[model samples]
Target: MDYDSVRTVDTAVADALIGERERQEETLAMIASENHVSEAVLEAQGSVLTNKYAEGYPGERYYAGCAYADEIEQLAIDRATELWGAEHVNVQPHSGTQANQAVYHAMLDPGDKILSLELTHGGHLSHGHPANFTGQMYTVEQYEVDPETGRIDYDGLAELAESFGPDIIVSGYSAYPRAVDWERIQAAADAVDAYHLADIAHITGLVAAGVHPSPVGIADFVTGSTHKTIRAGRGGIVMCDAEYADEIDQAVFPGGQGGPLMHNVAGKAVGFKEALTPEFEAYAQAVVDNAETLGETLVDHGLSLVSGGTDTHLVLVDLRDSHPDLSGGDAEDALTEAGIILNGNTVPGETRSPFDPSGIRAGTAGLTTRGFDGAAMEEVGDLIYRVVDNHDDEAVIEEVGERVLELCADHPLYAE
Candidate 1:
């Protein structure tokens, strides 16, 4: 991951790059939304294709020198189709947020009703959080998980859809822990005459590996990021039935973006190809198993998990019961000091600000990418709990920090 070529002209940037690589090499990346991509995907993302300006779909670009662009984009689409079985796939959207934007442009008008999960309730900002454009431009209503179960309240969502008369309903989530019932949500949308848009941005690889149920055939529109669980560098994709293909394409290009990042598309192609391997399935399964182990470890140490456990790659820990005086932000800072990287999150029925909420969210995707197994994750879970439980103890922080470095070194990333 050294930048020797860039170091020739830009020593400053090269220093920052080297520092970031060393940081990743030394710490635990427990952030749910982040993952390490393969060197092949990295190479493709930095390929010469970045200089191209492919403004449209394959073989139909506005530019003349796009034959290579067409070839790479089609391969991305083909591999993605084989992975998720979406009748139509558009890899042009710049991110998962932009992918959602394309769906809205294609299927919704300004001021259309959008019924989605609340931001503090495991939903993403693009799903109608007030700070996002979706909230300002659209009529937005939100649903929440059951306080008792910490799982999506399907009946409540259905009733809300019926009452709100939404034009669209969004499913999938960013911080949720349990497996989703996409069919039930689709039925709710159907009952309300609303389109179902499943944003599987965080679980794309799990779905592709069949570790999680897919929303491709059930939802009216399906969108995801390329890097979360799939390790496809960084990009977004929109998929739908053939009938909505052209609408999605147009929405993505003239509607939401101009020139496609051809290099990112190449990265997506390479990563999708990697995901198709049989070994990827084992990797995906290990991710879930590791999460389960981590969750159990926390619970065993008297930390409370939001969903009681996890069926996905991440877990949300509601710290109020075990450490009422400690804020999630404090816990986050303490863990960071201990070389564990994660984020403060708002739990359901949050009584704290988003900045210093009542919960911490962590994931095993990055650790699993570094080849962490059940035992390794259990130790990680122990270290995380120790840091959170004794957040103020400098001695504990120092000890955990050393252990984290040892773990990182044991499971070396990007080893030459």
Candidate 2:
């Protein structure tokens, strides 16, 4: 973790790099969309591939001296294909949002209708929030969860699909905590003669490890991040049937982005190879188990959980019932000060602004990757509840922060 080479060139940047590593070592990363990548992935991403310009897919590059680039990118595509069982895989979208953009670009025309989950109800901005390009470029309609259950109202979504007649239906989520019935969503798409884009950005590892149901063979297209649930460094992936292969490939390359981040592709290749090991399967299951333990512990402390629990790596907690006066923003700031890093998220039936929402979201991917089991996760949950319950008290925050440092020392990250 020493940035000696960087130090020789510029001490300022080197210090920031070293300090960032030390920060991760001390704090817990419980944010649902984040996880720790392996040292192998780190090295791969920091490799010399960054200097190359591979403007196209493997075997068809626009630049010379791309033989190695072709090899690495091909490896990444192949590994992703094997991982998700897709007829086609593109490993060069740079981000999950771009991967999604490629799909929209390939099949959709301007002003086409898109039906997706409402953002505050566990959806993403890429799913057509007014602030994003998708909203401006297309006609969008949103569905929501069953207010009483805190889960997706599949029947309601299907009904909406029928009425909206969307060109493409978007499934998957950012803050939702339940297992998605991919077939149900696909059926809705089929009934409307629409394409279905299942964005499994948050649950990529869970789906690949068989801990969560996959949308690959069922849905028309699947997109995700190489990080998050997976140990990949930082990149995006798109999977589709053979019929749409060329269209997707074109959309991802010149249509969306100019050049692929070869170092990131190398990272994806290495991380995907690591994910194929038996150890990763155990790790993925542990992520879900740890989330369940955390949720149970929170419930025991009188917290209300969305969907009452989780079937994935993250859980969404509605703080309204337990601490009506406490804003999620205040709770998040206090938790960060206490070395527990998670986000204040909007709940399904949110009654407050998105910025200072009514809930907090936490995940177990980072902790489980650091070797946290059910018992440890429960204790972490206890610590979280303590902080939320006593957010105004600096003494309690300080005590919990000390315990957090002790726990981090016990479960060190990037120790290699």
Candidate 3:
């Protein structure tokens, strides 16, 4: 139970580790795809279940003494299924990318066509980034966001689907701030006879809590990470209709991954149970409210936001008007120096490279989980403006970093 005793070895390494924890505690984590897991989830993740080698599903494990492992894994699957109304749930994939890969391996042949959102326009790399295995093995047709509105161009997607006739259509993103019209996407996929896949990795917690619309029943396959807003351990899950159960399970086990991480699965079970609580629903709603407030504050500060605003926990800030001289990379570095952590993101139709994008992505999941409200967000917004506006001001950065630590102390993420 003593993480300090377990993680701390040599004095230097222990000091560094302690410092890292202190940094996470003091800084606001605004990454859209990140969250702080509860102590219960952490306990489950660090449990003795990690020693087990449950290579297959319950009752068919490759190793002995898997009774507890089987129970935990089944509990995770049942909870995931109940939470999402999924007919079948596979809680074995190591990460979201792995879950997507398993689905691809299960359903598609080599060189099959996949229609997905463009990477620069808020899509995940596993959805078909050229450098990823999905893109290298499959023929990919990318749909894009509308240049003017910065929203999904559904009409353009339909046009692409008609022309390309892809075998699968992926609908989701890592940084998109708007709610997708799942029905429209499903209709488009249906029209082209393409399988619909929704990778709701960013908004899975919101969806489960009813703060965002669920894609469980609409999409043929639903994929998500347990950690994001779900506040679970680091792992991925796949859910689908009962018809695809056998194929999906086989693909995940013998096809894509080896043994399942039972300890993480236990953490997932705990997370899912928490998500089912009313308190978790309130937390999910708080994430959206905090994000909206943050986005409005950014806009009021003269920063351009992609899609003008957000309907979810994340915001993509386009800095072309506010900081024409600065790139997203510059903003990220400056903000990190100020103890406000976030990522530089590429806006749709960005001319800059991905490494130094034109926009920055921020989220409210971590802050909201730490109980930060609208007022706190407004203050955080001012800090962000200061950092972005005065990237070279070491004094200002140090001052804001101190303020960040103060704010973090006021609303500590974990009770001491």
The deviation in Å at residue 194 for candidate 3 is 0.7
In what order do the candidates fall by lDDT, top score first? 1, 2, 3
- Write the number of the candidate with greater lDDT, choosing between 2 and 3: 2
Per-candidate TM-score against the hidden true structure: 0.99, 0.99, 0.98
lDDT of 3: 0.92
Q: Write the per-residue lDDT of candidate 3 for residues 337-389, one digit (tens) a residue.
A: 89999999999989899999999999999999888999999899888988888
In order, what lDDT does every prediction score? 0.95, 0.94, 0.92
Off by over 4 Å in 2: none
Estimate, for each residue in 198-246, the C-alpha lDDT of model 2 and write its tens digit.
9999999999999999999999999999999988969899999999999
Candidate 1 residue pairs in clash (backbone atoms < 3 Å): none
Candidate 2 lDDT score relative to the true structure: 0.94
- Badly placed stretches (over 4 Å) of model 1 are none
Q: Show pairs that collide, candidate 3.
A: none
